[model samples]
Target chain A: MSGDPILSVDRLMMRFGGIVAVNELSFSAERRKITALIGPNGAGKTTVFNCITGFYRPSGGAIRLSHDDGRSIQLERLNDFRISKQAKVARTFQNIRLFPGMTALENLMVAQHNALMRASGLTVLGLLGLPSWREAEKRAIDLARAWLDRVGLLDRADDAAGNLPYGDQRRLEIARAMCTEPALLCLDEPAAGLNARESGGLNELLLSIRNEQGTSILLIEHDMSVVMEISDHVVVMDYGVKIAEGTPQAVRDDPKVIAAYLGADEEEAIAVMESGT
Target chain B: MSATSARPSHAAQPSGSAFIVKKALISALVALVLFSLMIGVRTEAGPQGGLIYWTRFGDLAALVGTVFGGSIIVELLRQWWGPVDKDSIVPKPVQSAISFAGRWLAPALLVFAVLVPVIFYDQRYILDLSILVLTYVMLGWGLNVVVGLAGLLDLGYVAFYAVGAYSYALLATNFGLSFWVCLPLAGILAAFWGVLLGFPVLRLRGDYLAIVTLAFGEIIRLVIINWQSLTGGPNGVSGIPRPTMFGIPLDNSDNGLAARLGIEFSPTHRLVFLFYLILAMALLTNWVTIRLRRLPIGRAWEALREDEVACRALGINTTTTKLTAFATGAMFGGFAGAFFATRQGFISPESFTFQESALVLAIVVLGGMGSQLGVALSALAMIGGFELFRGFDQYRMLVFGIAMVLLMIWRPRGLIGHRAPTVYLERNQSISSDLVKEGHG
Candidate 1:
């Protein structure tokens, strides 16, 4: 938490035709910390995640990603794939997007495509089965194996990813994103379909990633248990605008945060309902 | 309790015989309507050059009766079989047996292929047919890299074939280059066109990509036909030089290969040499593809096929992945085309039509996309099967169509539906085709 901000968002805005999906929003993610973005449905949490990950170009704002080596990237200018490649940012979809036909190990191996592509000399050396390519391939397999082991899917390495259980698929996806060795991991609802126990396991996994790998995490979650327990900082949004932002404890106690989740005071809700009727 | 009392639903079920009769009657009615004109009526030119008409009521009735009987038999089999499950039509034991056969089929076919030339060296017809089959097998393998491995549906694969053929034809006829020298040049030229095709269609997917590629093929063919001065237009280029055994020409002259080796002269020597030549080239294509599947780029291609969005998210440059796939597949097509030009000693726009592309694509699809053995088997079945139906006269196409339809119904994903993972840990498992994405582009 004390390190320089790994990612800083300045006055982000996203407009889809006439509707403003995100309006002049700003936030910063501290290095090696788990930051939670919590909002009710249709609050544009995922949209912000998309903007930061380069899936969408923000209408107005600058996303700056600073590396430990003193290099700063303007993510907004980069293409979708380059965000992950050069900017060192990785993300997982709310709906799992694993390469279902490939094996679990292959899913991880594919995530290491950039590194392996270079080592293979853009496939010319690898096509020749050169020793250099062989060593690179072996090292890639080892890295994939290590990530698979970390996610506890080492035993099911050869199984098609589509055949894995729901909980395992979620963890496998996270492992795949980590295989890219990203400086920041953005997850959209990692616990969306998980049971209580699986969410507990996910909490431990996310904690270990931050603790051991020193990778910053930004996650959107409806699961309060996940948000409250592991998040060092929390930002709450309501109707595409930031409602509250602070430490998890401070955000939880904020009246505005409670109003956004539980709906405004009783009188205010009744008045709003009367007007609608 | 009595069986009927215990399960009242059983009593409501129609008897097997009655159900079969009802279904058969419906089929007979439909067949009667369909064949009333098709089989019952016929028209021909009379002796005076006027039209003559006749009705064959007996044949129409016979066709209807056959449909009725066939429907009854099929219904009976269905009842006896308990239930029809589309996914598991072939029982587990039978599937395993097929897979077990598949395990050894590759090497066995290789052994048989090696011996075909020797066994049929005396028969010119068999040798020519074998060369045709090998040429198609090579084409199927080439297109498999794009449509199968990379999941790019290319309806213009024949354009690359034409490019290869024309490259060799132009180089050999105009510049007096040998086939050996022009072969690689043809492949390179085709690969260049492949990359060119890759650029404009980079953003297109699925059906749009297919339409654009189809148009590309037609454009190439039309260009060849209209460019009369360069391509000889519809007449085609003839006397294209034949391939030689290294530097030795396979001819009857005193300076020929047979004379240099001190062997007796026979036209069969050149045929045998051509057979082995195409065989070696086809094998080269197969070997390179197999090797590529184990490389990073190959894995990236598969990854792109599985989920392009995921590939992009994982930092894979999908544009280059697709371009490489097109280039590689086209290069092989070029090689096959060069061999074809030399083998026939002739080339024409008619030879590189949409039908040729469709035929090669059919071999790849029927063989199972991404399965090397499947493509090879499919090519053998399709090309050889078409030739087998030669005696069917006008009914040849009808019979071939029925066979293709039956094969598709039997194995919807092709002859081999499952994909074997390129690299595996612990134990290798074949993925069901259901999970394999056909790719957006």
Candidate 2:
């Protein structure tokens, strides 16, 4: 992959009137790198993903994606489909957003639908059930199976998405997002409630996505192992403002990062968290 | 692309799973089919293949078998080719024929239905009521859009019905417009009120929307009542021009249809003509409604009903979707209303009330939301069944009330309910969870 950041955010701000959820946060995620945005709780990392994915319009500033094909898209101006189509930005939610009633394979296939443009034709009404929007549904299943296999979830692909175990659901969420073949894949709190084994599975999956697929990753994760072990670049945030950015080792050494975790009210808790960091 | 992925080796296959499985399934399906066939069989031998050839069982089996069989085909496709994965296995043109017949059945069914009265009934009065049942079927199909597919729950549907009747009555009487011209005019004017009613409730949803639409229907009727000079007050504008076939009026004049056609003019022929007219309008309503449901706008509607957030996220403007539902539903209502005016040659505000909306809503709900067949069944139940109870007028409304209550308790989601949605149907690989999984989709 080219050595350019797949996503460039310059002074992004998201506000709900008086409360600024994410403030003037600027960062660049390099190509094919698992970049982590870690912060104490309520650090507005999810907000950043929402802005980039077109779930919410940013109040100010810009988020841009530099595609491998030499096209630069300003995601802030684009609607959700445009963000998904033009920028090729894909994301997972903090809580999984599967079409719960749908089966696991169907969920992934829906994500791959934008790639199905080759199949839209008049004589193909029989394929309305076929969802011929994409030629790669079989390929999509093959891909979904591979991803599920990577996360050890190939067996549960037939189950309703809602019926999957929590860990499998998280992995399935990641798999669903990846089905879009996004240039920049953003994860929202992927490691939140996973057990150690599941978290390890997530870490390896994220790394494989980066290495095997050459996809640039911008992940919002709280688990230290996932963030520090897999991430190439780490950005630390506190209450919506960026406090530190660098290699995991360097950001782990920053004093401001320590102070930010020492935080507004939970200075003692921050001291404890920072001491571990 | 990968057929091997579909059938994995070493999975536990059911024991004795050979031709035994085939025999078992066929026998079960035969049993089920026979069980269904038994319902349509008449023990009383009533009228030798007449209207009494219906059993609640046949209708029930026809509906249930249709649903399960449709899903079975989907399941087979999923098994054979890995997965259907998309919405259509065929193209739009292939479905057009089925959809065309589905839509045009109103006219065909209407023609066949009109023949029923002339053949079975000796009384002309019963023919008039049959005409009325056919009219409501068209009306239910119209209102089904707003309340059924779109999930808007409009209670004031009858207001549009009244508006069309009045528009035709007033325009025909004052402006002297012919039946053919006023027919379309009535629909347009009714649609205008539909839009007017739609605007105020743009932001309202669910029960609030229901209450507002109910009130709006009442408001239209009240306006018709209080607007003395325009709607001819509560006494209603009468002496409306009769709808003639081409230039030939069905009047008993020397220059009327009898003289022109060189056939003996009977009032039954006139009723027959009106029956045909109502049938045409009804067929047009069914045809247009079905086609609309398959369009981009219609798909957007189903999407909106599934999850409003997902729909908006897909960039569907909910406002436009809701308005279109109102406008389309009202357009059909207007068609029915215009026909009503022509049939009666009169109009009144009394016809457009809260009761009318409730009846229309009842039809949509009972017939099954978003299913064309469901709505037709609902209309058939409400109009046809109610007409059947005419000799027991004292207990007609009571029977309707009891039926609705029992129906609500038994099948609260409405008879057929909304479809299981294509996305789920296309991918659900479960062979056993079919029965319990009915309402969740």
Candidate 3:
């Protein structure tokens, strides 16, 4: 489905003091596909996500993001906000970092800040109540409303993001990331605390985003059901190194992936995996 | 275990009169310990230039007796009313009344402000006081951009004010520039300083940012004080030009506004003009801030406050956002400073002190941070309330401190604690202050 991968990491390395958090990890996520990074706790999946999103600078390696327009960006070279601004990479936190005090609609509106900022002539024309600025603001609100409708939170647009129910907040967060119009979306543990039904809903949302919006998603998830169901490609890690990577069926059958998840012997892991499936 | 539980129940059911008496005795003892030195002692200088001291045991006893009686009555009332609900200290009706007042208060205050100069045209003191109050309101509004909206705690806001005042003073005195020309120039210069201050403190937040800004303010004042060649050092720049109505001076001259209007030339006219001038400037600051709040940049500022990391994730350039906030706040401070220079006809480094910064910050905080109406009302209350307690002289600050403590206890988020959403869909709902975060920086 791709001429070239949307994102590729080459021999990435990250170190915190003497501890190597990630070591010589390499992976590529194809455009318009859902790529899931799965690992046990502290397997450095989030570190990889952080490096890709420019939250942390890797000690050694290259993170290259290719745009649809043939613009290739070295994500590691960019700073935190610039990664999102120029590289078209948007991410949500594991701990849900929505602007808690702001309304749900405002949360989405803030995501479109860069575009509206330019349309408002850096705020001067907007201050003067110019029609152009008003038009841009109206368009932004419309986009926000559309996202809210998609997330089934149109009625709750005016409610504070913090006050939303857990499932609603999770959906709202995804909607917020979408509002940025990012080419690549990174989500950290999107279904971490969701119930079975909520996670099922999340799978549908992620699929729709891929199918309808054509936005490539790179996610770090511990929930296997979410990882296997929606992920077109799966990368499994253990102790900061990629142990297995393939389609969901192949990775699920990988003995190393099961051993890493269960921390058991290869034979036992395979037996346990077979029984669980 | 049953016997122990029964004993506890027996203690809990102690007669009300006995329980009240026990509580009153404890309160009396505590009051005696607290006021023993403060109210029970008297000290004065002897005629021979030695210190003399006396004890007011009788007065102390009377105070202790009053406290004991007060405690007993309070205990009795508590028993009659049952346990107080911690959540609802003020009744529902009272809260609704306050909200109703808050909703209509802004327009009412504006109407009252407009009428002040007209009604008190002959009262020079009230006119001067009103001008002073308006000046603080403008300053509070200016600082609100940096501190309240952006969530940056700046302790050196007076630096911008000093910059503006000196800019106007040097320009008007040296180049003979009018107030109209210097006002904008001063604001620009102060904004430049704001950006200068902003750069070094970009990585800093909360108390550290506050400290650096506080130092920046002192540095500006110290530079002005020590730079004798340009600023005249402690002597200050005197003979600053006064403001005029367009080209017409508000003076007793042939080409003055009074003569042109064919009205009697009086000093009261000038005071009235100054009042109107400051009022207009304050309103302009309010108008611009409110409009800016609905803009992308304004929302970005709030988002930055709510969560800096989240802002960066959303691709907001926090450096520029913080710098713009600082520059905007400083520009208004500069405008107010320029007005101060013109109104006084003199400029001094002493005028822009840490105390001035503290006063303006106090006004902003007391006014509930971002609310424009709250800032204006707080300015009036602080300035006018200070004058109201002028007769107390020494006890003024003591009373003010107690009042401040009471206000903090009652409304920790300052007056008008609830935040009105800048832009909302459908019905606009006010957010409780408990949900709002005071920005880290």
Model 3 stretches with alpha carbons more than 4 Å out: A1-3, A265-277, B1-52, B56-103
Q: Local error of candidate 2 at B374, Å?
A: 2.2
Q: Which residue pairs show collisions in model 3?
A: B152-B441, B206-B441
lDDT of 1 by residue, B79-129 (tens): 666543344123467557767877788889999999998888789999989
- CAPRI-style class, candidate 3: medium
Native contacts kept, each candidate: 0.72, 0.09, 0.71
Error of 3 at A239 (Å): 1.8
TM-score of candidate 2 restricted to chain B?
0.70
- Leading candidate by TM-score: 1
Give per-residue CA lDDT, model 3, range B296-371, as digits (tens): 9999988888899999998999999999999999999999999999999988889989999999999989889787
Q: What global local distance difference test value does model 2 have?
A: 0.72
- Report how far off residue A133 is in candidate 2 (Å): 12
Ranking 2 against 3 by DockQ, winner: 3
Docking class of 1: medium
Task: List model 2 lDDT by residue over A1-277, tens digit each.
Answer: 2357888899999999899999999999998888999898888988888888888999999988888888888889987556765677777778766555445765565565444333333214323534553344355567767766777766777666656778888888788777778888888889989999889878888888899999999988878888889999999988898878999999887777766665445776576556656
- Interface CA RMSD, all predictions: 1.4, 7.0, 1.6
**Each prediction's TM-score versus the true structure:** 0.94, 0.66, 0.92
Q: Candidate 1 on A21-64: residue-level lDDT in tens?
A: 99988888999999999999999999999999888999998899
The superposed Cα distance between candidate 3 and the true structure at residue B36, in angstroms, equals 4.1
Q: What is the lDDT of residue A15 in candidate 1?
A: 96
